[model samples]
Target: MSGGGFSRLPNGTVVVAVSLPSPLGDGSVARFLVHAANRARALTRLRNLGLRAVYLRGNAEPPTPDEITAVLHHPDGLLWRLQGAPAAELWHPFRSSSPLRNRWA
Candidate 1:
């Protein structure tokens, strides 16, 4: 899933899909899949990383089973990309994504 909603795994964790406008103010949306113990924690993880605009919307795009697995196995429990980005685009860890940094410099 790429827009919103969450899925519970067999191990009792959750994978949440969140979409928000990029911090760069470029009219582009950033999508994220986060694996956490629950929904609040998932959002909190993003917020803690300076993504304050993110929130769970309706289940417009829930993470697919495969997408959940991808987030689950990620060490930091997060994967991100620009919405509508090419399929060949990479999903990056939040810390390294340009969207979170101020490009003004």
Candidate 2:
């Protein structure tokens, strides 16, 4: 298992930050606000984008008006760094042995 599983609710928005392996030897991290049914789905989507290192940040249930504003108005910027990896572990949400299997099914 990669980190903890989140509640299977589709009415929330999760903030995801991913670290892209750089070819220049300098890594970069980018943040995105994703709207999904749950954190598992969010992680899955991020993985589908071909990112190997992803992390889940804060989330809001039934996102508040302010939260929406923040996502739309002031998007997160990428951070350049020399080292360090994503904070969260990456796992398949639909693995047969995963607790989230039934939830996705």
Candidate 3:
């Protein structure tokens, strides 16, 4: 388990941020942010997208306001990046296969 949590928008929507080990077994942790109507739906969205073991139990690494806006502005309302990677690194959209590869693995 990396870190994860949820943040709700004033409009009643939620942004869920979770950091998990890359499913690709690349030994790198990747953070996923999902914007949805509710926290449950947000996590479910990721599960449906192929992160089958997804879950949120504590508010350890909730999305910051800026991060929420980034996901909301994105076409798919979903974004991901390597854990602790430089802010200059681009956040990738949801892909069946991860985009992190082994750069930080």
Better of 1 and 2 by TM-score: 1
Q: Which stretches of candidate 2 lie over 4 Å from their true place?
A: 1-28, 55-105
TM-score for each predicted model, relative to the true structure:
0.80, 0.35, 0.84
Of candidate 3, the 10-residue stretch with the lowest lDDT total is 96-105
**Candidate 2 vs 3: which has more TM-score:** 3
- lDDT, model 1: 0.77
Question: Highest TM-score among the candidates is held by which one?
Answer: 3
Q: Model 2 reaches what TM-score against the true structure?
A: 0.35
Report the C-alpha lDDT of model 3 over 25-102, residue by residue, as the tens digit. Answer: 667788889999999999898777767778898898889887888898998898988777787998888754655432
User: Over the stretch 1-105, how does candidate 2's per-residue lDDT look in tens digits?
Assistant: 122122332345443333334444334322233445556666676556444455544432233343334443443311122224354533222234533223323
Q: Cα lDDT for residue 16, model 3?
A: 94
TM-score comparison, 1 vs 3, better candidate:
3
C-alpha lDDT score of every prediction, in listed order: 0.77, 0.37, 0.82
Cα lDDT for residue 39, model 1? 89
Which regions of candidate 3 fall more than 4 Å away from where they truly are?
24-26, 96-105
Quality of model 3 by C-alpha lDDT: 0.82
